[model samples]
Target: MSGNRYGHSSPPMFLVDSGGGHPGEHQYYHQQVLGQGNPPLVPCWTFPPARAKMKKRGTMNNGMTWVLIMILLLVFAALGLGAYQILRLQNQVERLTQEMPAEVESITAQKQVGLPAELIKMKQIRADFIGAHLIGHADQRSSSGTLNWETQLGTAFINGIQYHNGGFQINETGYYFVYSRVEFLIYTCSHKDSHTHRVSVLRRGENRTIMEDHQEGFCKSSNNQKWMTGSHLSSLQRFQESDWLFVNVSHPLFLSKNFQNNFFGLFKI
Candidate 1:
């Protein structure tokens, strides 16, 4: 009957020890006393410690720096590769320009044997035959049927329907120039099935293009279907050196490798 028991409502929560308990710090708890005499305690709950406060700005900056470096390296590599390719292409163009001749005089000058009158005759006949074939009136048809032979030569002419079987004969003489015409001809190295510009001298015709296709190194189309006649060797006295320029021709259109099977018809105009 001497003391009255009073209950305490509010409790104290420390800033330093805001969490439930200090590690190894006695879990002592204090609350407010209301009326005085024997005070009754209220349950106390500890607050949580402040979470780690610093922002990871430095970490983010480092990550960004690394990314930028990688990007720059990639960019530089691409630029360098592009520059190298351009230089290579330019060098290639210059080399080709220096090594090859595009003009008629430059090309013809290469031949030690000058062009004589007989070359004109050969070109004329070849042109005529080609023209006929294009018009569907073929004098000789290629294996692909692009060309056809109309007549076989008689015994007097060594060069019969097949140029390889014989040579040719010439009875006229004069200053001559050699020129070639190509139709649907492909270089062996190129393995092409299309027409290309190419020529070669049978007896050192200098102005001839070695090979229309570059890959085949030094293979030349047969000049057998060709002709050569001139006063190049025979002086003015040999008004008409009896010479025969016979050619052996084959149809490369569909690859008539057994050239003998393809008989090309040729004659003098």
Candidate 2:
């Protein structure tokens, strides 16, 4: 230790040897006094060269910086991909919304255009028409057994036309085609005699004589039973509202209960 003039001890100086015995080895290390007074020299620590340590630190720092930059690039790429997906979804939703109103309007227009034809087709299916059948046996010869045939079949008339007392009363005025059929049968054939069957139509009020038909049959068997049929059809005849109409047969006793053999029908034209 060396004392200065101001009476403070001076710190020792470190000395590293520049001359060496080997190629890479240090020769010696010493402490040199810098003041005018000669002092005892002290040995000091010799630091190793700084190039290798600095190079190692620089390499570590460069590796960490590249890692940080790669992480930032990955984060940015993820964000961009997410944004692209969101934009695609938004565009799809917008396209569907734009087409929805056009589809709805097209369907509505089709329904509106077809409405009148559909109504007309439905009206044609339900119209004013009627049909009936005489449903029991009757006696033509006996006056007591001959009664008005009024019992009707299932759903006899439609559109206000009704069956009452063997007559059809009309509710609407229109031209109508009328038709009727009757079956006549007899158990005993007495001789070879000609028989006459008649069916006629009459309207109640002004036009009573509308139409009539006749059927003739000759007894072919000497003692066997005989059968005949009579049918009457009228052309399109004009009728009025509340008009009553019926069928009349000369021999009602021969009428069988078979509805297929005895029927009456009318249809408005």
Candidate 3:
């Protein structure tokens, strides 16, 4: 121990040798003062090196970053695919829209091309029908056993048929259904009185009866009252072009004056 000028004892110095035998190894020293208790040395703890732990943390951080990057990339890829699909659909729609007018025009052109043929077919159908309906005329009387008709009176018409010389001339050759009706008025009842209606066709200056109807016994002789009767003749006949049809009745004078009661009509079948 050594005393300073202030009379305080100085600490004693002690040298400590390192265990290494290498030359010029470093030495450590500690000092302790007399009459002072030495402090207890605390045990030092050594931890593992930080480099490996830092490397593990860095590796974990890199893995997490890579995983996030991959997720982001997948999301972007999905978005890109969706955008491409939308664009493709838009293009298809635009293309179809551009072509629609041409398709419509083509359809219209086809219809236009077929229009004339359809119209011609319809005209032919209309021309194929041959029919005529002629009503009786009150002013015109029967001549040579043939009854005359009104050409332009009520409900009287001729289509594909001609009227000449008190007969209807067929303009087209086909089977025809000919019909005639005649109503008669008798002032006095007589059993012997009879009625006859006949429809005939004349072809090439030759006449042939096609339909005939007879009526009798419709009146009482004892009563001597006014009576009425009717006769209808109808038949299906084949006619050639230029053939003429005529209607004849037994009693022209006694025929009813009503146009509806006396009519001659024929229609091609």
Candidate 4:
């Protein structure tokens, strides 16, 4: 036996001669060494426990599960928010639909109330204008140097003026356009035959002719035949309140019997 450098005695060593050694001889020698009751030395190693590895794997699986659960929760929350917005929009549409008819009716009522008032205002403006139109009648006669007129005959009317005793009574003082038409008939045409038509105004018992027409010496028919003629007079004149206007003719018997042949009218300008 030899000693090691650490001053410890080494184990016993065996040397085999290889000149004619049999394969079984080596095994025999090792069996003889182990049979001495000395077991061979082996190294021991320490590793982590199986339960610790299993626990780590289980922790990883739990973390994955929690992540999946969080994703599912977030998806459900988004769906709920979308549903709330849709419901709010639908409610707004319903409210507007309910109010539409009343709004339309209110607008229509405003138009209905406004139109008639405008029409009535226009009618009042038309009525405020002063004018009159008078026609002749067969019963009308010129006896007081002024011809009488039919106030209620065919197409005869008076406004802002009055007819009193064969004259028009002015109610408003202003400028007026006065006009008259007279037709004449003659049974015999002869020399010195004449006719005159005049439009006169009377204010404060003074009579003045504003317009006149005279026709004479035109009766060339000598065979005593009937003749027809006409005279018309018009003028712009100024008057005061309570003034009277009248029409006069030189020959009353020659006046036409046809009522349509004579007319008189005036209007404020």
Best by TM-score: 4
Q: lDDT per residue, candidate 3, 1-269, as tens digits?
A: 55789998665643333343632322222222343333344455555678789889999999999999999999999999999999999999999878773312222211233322333333357766567767777855655668888877766777777898679988888887677777888887677778888998899999998888888888768475778887776666889999989988877878787766677777676
Rank the candidate models, highest lDDT first: 4, 3, 2, 1
Q: Report lDDT (CA) for all predictions.
A: 0.33, 0.53, 0.71, 0.73
Candidate 1, position 44, lDDT: 65
Runs in model 4 lying further than 4 Å from the true structure: 1-125
TM-score (C-alpha) between model 3 and the true structure: 0.51
**Model 1 lDDT per residue over 101-220, tens place:** 322233232342323222333445555321011011123334422332222321111221122212222334432222322233233333232333232223323232222321222224
Better of 2 and 4 by TM-score: 4
Q: How many clashing residue pairs are found in candidate 3? A: 0
Q: Candidates sorted by TM-score, descending order?
A: 4, 3, 2, 1
- State the lDDT at 120 in candidate 3: 35
In Å, residue 202's CA in model 1 sits off its true spot by: 8.4
The global Cα lDDT (0 to 1) of model 3 is 0.71
lDDT (Cα, tens digit) per residue for candidate 4, span 98-156: 87743122222113233223333333577775666676666645566577778786666
- Which candidate, 3 or 4, has the higher TM-score? 4
Residue pairs with clashing backbones, model 3? none
Provide TM-scores for the models.
0.28, 0.43, 0.51, 0.52
Worst 10 residues of 4 by lDDT: 103-112
**Count of steric clashes across candidates, in order:** 20, 3, 0, 0
Off by over 4 Å in 1: 1-54, 102-245, 249-269
